[model samples]
Every structure is written in C-alpha cells, then in structure tokens.
Target: MATSRRVSRVAELIKREVSQMLLHDIKDDRVGAGMVSVTDVDVSGDLQHAKVFVSIYGTDEARAETMAGLKSATGYVRSELGQRVRLRRTPEIVFQEDRSIERGNRVISLINQLNQNRQIDDAVAIEEVDEFDDE
Candidate 1:
C-alpha cells in the first residue's frame, strides 16, 4: 500500500527525468520528433517494473520513431534513474504510446458536428411545421 505509493512517486520522477533527458540531453536522431510528453506512469507494488505512457505530437512515423528510440535507450534510462533515485534495484521501464488525448478530441469533434447538424434539421422541421399550420 504505502510501498506502492513510494514506487508511484519514483515512477513519476523517472518520467520527469526521462522527459528532460529526451528534450535536452538525448542526441538520437530517432527522437527528433515534434514533442513528447509523459502522460502516465504505473509502477508495480514490488517496485521492479514501471509502465510509462507517452504522448507524441507529430506524424505517425515520427511517433513510431520516437517509441523505437525510447525502447533502445531503456537501459540507459534505467541506469540513470538508479543513479538519481537511489533505489536498491532499478525498475525496468516499459514504453507505451497513449492515444487517449487524440481519441477524446475526436469524440468531441464528432459531438460538435452532430449538434450542428441537429440544429439545422430542427430549423427546417420547425419551418415545415409552421407552413403546415398556416395552410
């Protein structure tokens, strides 16, 4: 319970460190996408594994490249985390590309379009109803 919280904190710290490293320190060409953000981190209770959710803004190819770059650099990232976080054993980092934001935006856009269409239809229907009443 409490240990899980500690692990979660460490996971967040790792995410921050990794983000900073990617932004300023990493020199990999594959990581040269538009921007990458750490969205979520889930750490196991045993503190031996962490799942990192990352959101990338760019083309799909760029996102895939960034993911590949991160996967290749996981060992280096884990070592860096161990040095900075003072853990007995550094947890293995797993990268996952998150599309939740994209999905949410799509849903909102669909709702707005539907609402607009409904408004137009209602206006037409009301006009027809008034014409029939007059007749």
Candidate 2:
C-alpha cells in the first residue's frame, strides 16, 4: 500500500503526462471533435488505477466522440506513460467526463436570472407607490 503523499504525487504526475499526450501525442480525430482539457486526476491509493477527468467544450455529440476516442486510446496512453514515467507499473487509465463546471455555470445563470427578475419587480413596486402618492 502506498502512503497518501505518494499517491497524490503519482496522480499529479499522471495528470501532467496525460495532458501532454492529449495536447501533442494523441492523433484521434474524435478527440479533436471538441476542445478538451484535463480537469483533474484521481489515483487509487494502491497506484494501480487512475481516473482522468476531462472537461470538453462542445456539443453533446462531440463530447461523446471525444470520450470514445479516449477510451480506445487507453492502451496507447498506458504504454506511453510506462515509457515516460519511471514507475514499477503504469497505472490503468480511465477517462471520465467531469460535468461539474457545466453544472456550476448553470447554477450561476439561474442566480443571475433570478436577480434580474427581482430588480424588475422592485422597479414595478416603486412605480406603483409613486402613482399611489400622486392620486
């Protein structure tokens, strides 16, 4: 079993190397369908598996295609990591689409919309009070 610090270090290294691969080494057309970026990497405590979180900016279909491409290229990525990283064994790579950013953006938009509606209502109330005072 690896210590927590070692596990974190490995996860960061994997994240950096995989980001480099996605940027330069990967040649899959589907991966290029969307603008993909690595959001985070989670490695198991044992260092036997790594989950690569990615945030893609595009339509739903494009996101799907990019995920499929990542899945298919797992073996290649593992091999490359094995070569570049001096680990006893390369951790298995699993690509996961991180939707947290999308969700957060949605929440922010909702809040903004609500604020606009509140301001409109307040203006209407103020106008009503002014008319009442004149009459």
Per-structure clash totals for the candidates: 0, 0
- Supply the global lDDT for candidate 2: 0.95
Question: For residues 36-135, could you state the per-residue lDDT of candidate 2 as single tens digits?
Answer: 9999999998899999999999999999999999999999999999999999988988999999999999999999999999999999999999999999
- The collision pairs in model 2 are none
What's the lDDT for residue 67 in model 2?
96
What TM-score would every model get versus the actual structure?
A: 0.91, 0.96
Where does candidate 2 stray beyond 4 Å? none
lDDT values for all models: 0.85, 0.95
Best by lDDT: 2
Off by over 4 Å in 1: none
- Residue clash pairs of candidate 1: none
Error (Å) of candidate 2 at residue 28 is 0.9
